[model samples]
Target: MRDIYSNVLVKQSLTPAVRTATATGTAVDRNAGGGAMFQNALVVVTTGVITDATHTITVEDSADGTSYATVAAEYLQGTAPAIVAADDSKTYELGYLGRKRYLRVVSTVAGATTGGAVAALVVLSDPRVTPVVRA
Candidate 1:
């Protein structure tokens, strides 16, 4: 079998931002493959604390990264541990088939007492094109 790593045209795994306060994370353009959107992308959110918190993970897109919009109907693929503190992770499909140029993982979280942090991963691919590094 051929090396699977070569098939991945663009890939990035980032914590993006972690919350100790209520500040929403800044944009993560990553500039993956010169914002080609490639074929598809995968977004995975992993929680750390998640104590009595509510988090909405959504995928957003933009041309200038100044004004953005949601991509999917149910873009928010998962929620925080509401009932039990188990299952503190989720993976969402970031379908870039007909999406825009710039994409980012938006993690909006809120808590009554305190405790919530997450690390996210994004992977993009397009067999015909090569990955580009943004300036």
Candidate 2:
């Protein structure tokens, strides 16, 4: 058996302006052969609005960091926590079934009208350990 320590493999931010129905924000590439091993991860997104109204935000992931897939499709309404004005920041924690190499975030709402703003994105990996035997 063997034991592995967990560490912060990567961290980044994506704030691409939305002009069309959808826009790709940014890509997080982890090309380390085995990739980052973890059991859980976290995604933090911050937004600012001209008015205290509702806005929608979505998070996604990609294997290659280029072509992404939707991880969270639900629209984060104003009622949700961390969905407040830009003055404040929202932190979201996401659980993973297995290990993932690449991750990304996408904003459905576009333009200054919606107050779409992203402060930063943080990812956390789980610690892995295995049994060891000695003679």
- Residue 123 lDDT, candidate 1, scale 0-100: 62
Q: In model 1, where do residues sit more than 4 Å from their true spots?
A: 9-31, 34-37, 74-84, 89-97, 131-135
TM-score of decoy 2: 0.53
TM-score of each: 0.64, 0.53
Question: TM-score winner among the candidates?
Answer: 1
Model 1 lDDT tens row, 32-106: 445544555556556665565565666666778788886655543343222213435444444444355556666
Model 1, CA-based lDDT: 0.51
Clashes of 2: 1
Query: Scored by CA lDDT, what does every candidate get?
Result: 0.51, 0.44
Residue 131 alpha-carbon offset, candidate 2, angstroms? 19
- Write candidate 2's Cα lDDT for 10-58 as tens digits: 3564552322233445555433224434444556665433243333445
